[model samples]
Target: MTEPVRLTDIAELAKVSEATVSRVVNGKAGVAAATRQAVLAAMDQLGYDRPARSRQRNAGLIGLIIPELNNPIFPAFAQVIDRTLTLRGFTSVLCTQSPGAATEDELIEALTERGVDGIVFVSGLHADQTASRDRYTRLITRGLPVVFVNGYAPDVKAPFFSDDDAAAVQLAIAHLRELGHERIGLAVGPSRFVPSRRKAEEFRRLMAPVAGEAEVERLLVNSLYSVEGGHSAASFLLDEGCTAMVCGSDLMALGAIRGARKRGLSVPRDFSVIGYDDSPLIAFTDPPLTTIQQQVSSIAAAAVRALLDEIAGLPVPSTEYLFQPELIVRGSTAACPSS
Candidate 1:
């Protein structure tokens, strides 16, 4: 007894190409698990027979490795990278690194073992000039198309995308200077990272003349990119008699505000704080943080496009593509207390 079945029925049921269904039904390869499931669902809905021994496709998966998903900034970037990859007909495998967990090298090796088409790294070891570059060179030797985001190693042969940290600090300093914040302070991450070094250098240059020698020393504080780091850095700034603070991240800025309140100080009154990376939900925080907004979509899209272009044998620009951040004025920052 022959059952009633047609390609159109299978295609409509699976919501996929008749070719995909045919590939699955004929025990062929190159179909994704999720896609294969969709086809199977469609067949079941249409009461079609099951395939004998269908397997999933492993060819189109791309690896996206990022550092520390706890920060909103990293997650925001990851989301964009994932969406952009999916739109390009590639399945994304997001690998996030945490303390004592999977290391970047291990993640890369695993992804490669799984036969990823390419790799995208965000805020990885490339940002640290002190870190070894042999891993990157080895990947290059292995003929893998790797793209870097928010980290640029000049010697590494790959397309890179990042925010202009110097310009970001300059923008923040300019705004504070305009507001008559003569005794301004800075709270940023460690200087080992390229972005932090650029920010610190630009800050010193800008503060050298505008602020006095004692004030300049008081104005700079290095710490982690967290709320607690911000709290401690702001405490130092306050102890040094700083009236305003410029932080490296929105999370740090929030911490600065907390530090001030702990001492019975009011933001924009007793202390003014500015933050970087105007990530999602930052505006909804108490007093609404004034921050520098990273061009996430543009940067993410550019990185993916560069990697895909390289994968397709197209010429990718070897230079770093730096996107400038915009300063968003919000309630967290205001006129200096003297004004």
Candidate 2:
């Protein structure tokens, strides 16, 4: 048998009075939804079982489809989105795609069959220039409420939330330039994805004035958004005599560091590196990374809000919303060695 829940213990943990805890525990209607959630959370944290009547009935199910969880950035986004949905009384059904796992279409089909109230896509095929947008069109045609994150399709009628990829690249380049590094390179993902394309284009436009068109082309390297990809791209850039590089993701940055070390070079002493998506635990890496921080919390909250509005039959403009990213300077960068 489960131990009884002590009212005083819950009140103190939840920062509410005994009466409030009692009301929440007994399933009274007076407590605010957020407060009730808080009480329930406190009970869970304290290892106390909730009263059967106090359990909340989920308002509806929301499908969240993301590329993969291997990348820390995706998990970070998932946590925020899931928490926000829970607070709003909705249960989030997360569908993740991997090399041999179910495809996006398969996941969407399963979600639709389950009668989800809405859906959110993160870095999905909508971001791939080569992928067809007809799948999204069919969903919209069926009156399904959907939202896209980190991708934009001009013809797709949905609200999109994305980081300012162009701005991110510009910021990284400007910072390296200010450090007197003229031989800067860009290591990004495949050009087919929207974010990679934006970053690469901005890199070319900004570096053209400094490195000329021909040299700028040599400075840009397209690879996978993985550590191995970063390592390969960095090897090529290092051979091109690039003293600094701006990577598409923090994982790539870590790989670049490994590659530079393999070439008998010291980071920030012989070469400098900057990364994007300042993912969790990146700051704890040896010589904590200097990276661009995507506004994950803000972006996730905005995406959830827009999705809820659509589900509520509110008029939501089908336009892309770009959130600004911040540059987090750390130990991974310094004045160009020759400077």
Candidate 3:
């Protein structure tokens, strides 16, 4: 037999009074929905199974599809989303994919077969400009509640959550310019992804005032979203007299540091780098990385609210919700060389 649940434990975990926990646990009618959700989330966090009487209160299961867990940012999004769903009495089913692993289509098929009430996709196929949008179109036609994150497709009739990619590039440029770095360059992901395209276009637009439009293209390098990709892009830009570089991710920034070291140069002394995605451990790196912070918590909350509205048969507007990004300055960047 399972151990009896304790009201004090739930109260402490939920940061609420024992009386409130008592009301929620006993299924009393006066407990506020917000308080009840906090209690449920606390119970889930503590691995306490709900009382048998409360089994019927579960909202439903939600499928959360992500590109991969290799990047710290993806897991960061997953943790907040899972916690939010549990608080609202919904279960989260996480699906991850890699280059050679289960394709996105396979994951979607499995999720649909399992009768998931709704789906939340993060950096899925919808972000690929070259990919067919028919998959998302079919889901909309079937009336399934879905939300996309970090990617936007005009043809997909679902709510989209994305960080302002163009603004991020602009922020980096402005900061580097203030540091007297005239030969600034960008190292971003492949051109096929929506974010990559936006960053590139914005970089060119801003650089055109400094360098002609044709010369701006020479300072931009398209590569993978990895450390090696950053190294390669940085190497090319450095050879072209670039004293500072902006990378698509922190991993790339670290790689760019390595590239600078290989050429017998010290970071912030001979070169400076800025990265995107202020992930959890990024601040603790060798030289705490300067990065663009995506408002993951707010975006995840908004995405969940939209999905819940759709699930509840409420009128949810199909529009793109853009979250502003903040640029975090740290030790990895410095004034340009005076040589």
The models' CA-based lDDT, in order, is 0.87, 0.93, 0.90
Question: What is candidate 2's lDDT per residue for 1-339, written digit by digit as tens?
Answer: 967768898999999999999898888888887788789889998888787888677899999999889999999999999989988889999999888999999999999999999999999999999999999999999999999999899899899999999999988998999999999999999999999999999999999999999999999999999999889999999999999999999999999999999999999899899999999999999779999999999999999999999999999999999999999999889899998
Give the per-residue lDDT of model 3 (tens digit) for 274-301: 9999988999987889899999999998
Among all windows of ten consecutive residues in candidate 3, which has the lowest summed lDDT? 49-58
**Cα displacement (Å) at residue 307, model 2:** 0.9
Specify the highest-TM-score model's number.
2
lDDT of 1 by residue, 1-339 (tens): 976988788897677889988887776767775676677667778877775565333338889999887799999999888767765668899999888999889999999999998999999989988999988889988999999998789899888999999999999999988888888889989888888888888898999898755567667888998999999999999998888889999999999999999999998777889999998999998888989889999999999989889889898877899899999999887788887
How far residue 125's Cα lies from its native spot in candidate 3, in Å, is: 0.7
Please list the residue runs of candidate 3 whose C-alpha ends up more than 4 Å from where it truly belongs after superposition: 1-13, 25-29, 32-56
Ranking of all predicted structures according to lDDT, beginning with the best and ending with the worst: 2, 3, 1
TM-scores for every predicted model: 0.83, 0.96, 0.91
